[model samples]
Target: FEEINDELIYKKDFDIDTIKYAILSKLNPKYLGLSPEVIILEL
Candidate 1:
């Protein structure tokens, strides 16, 4: 989470969409142990 935020902030021109995609990409793999289907549904 902090890493994703740092990546977004570090890239001076990052927008919300880019930040969201980056965070989701990073989280999805780590969160795979949980119910990804439910998570996606909620999101």
Candidate 2:
């Protein structure tokens, strides 16, 4: 997982849901170009 910058957390209008979505989106199989099964196997 990627780390969010401290600057982003300190933003005045930051929303928890938005940050969660951003992190979840990166975990999508299409983004990593790997199948879910392969990901689980590696883990």
Candidate 3:
């Protein structure tokens, strides 16, 4: 995240893989897992 001219923006350098892994963990309650339903909203 970055603040520019009083507005916040998602940094292009942000690691997308990290976001995917986070979503995967949330969907997998039993243990570490991966799913095809992972959705990343880039802004």
Q: What TM-score fits each model?
A: 0.34, 0.36, 0.40
Full candidate order by TM-score, most accurate first: 3, 2, 1
Tens-digit per-residue lDDT, 1-43, candidate 1: 2367457434456566665566677674855655443222223
lDDT of 3 at 30: 68
Arranged by lDDT with the best first, the candidates are 3, 1, 2
lDDT of 2 by residue, 1-43 (tens): 3338644444547666676557667775566633232221213
Whole-structure CA lDDT of model 3: 0.69
Q: Where does candidate 2 stray beyond 4 Å? A: 1-12, 29-43
- Span of ten consecutive residues with least summed lDDT in model 2: 34-43
Whose TM-score is greatest here? Answer: 3
Q: What is the lDDT, from 0 to 100, of the residue 9 in candidate 1?
A: 37
TM-score of 2: 0.36
Across 1-43, the per-residue lDDT of candidate 3 in tens digits comes to 8799999998667577887777776774666444465667658
Model 1 RMSD in Å is 9.2
Best by lDDT: 3
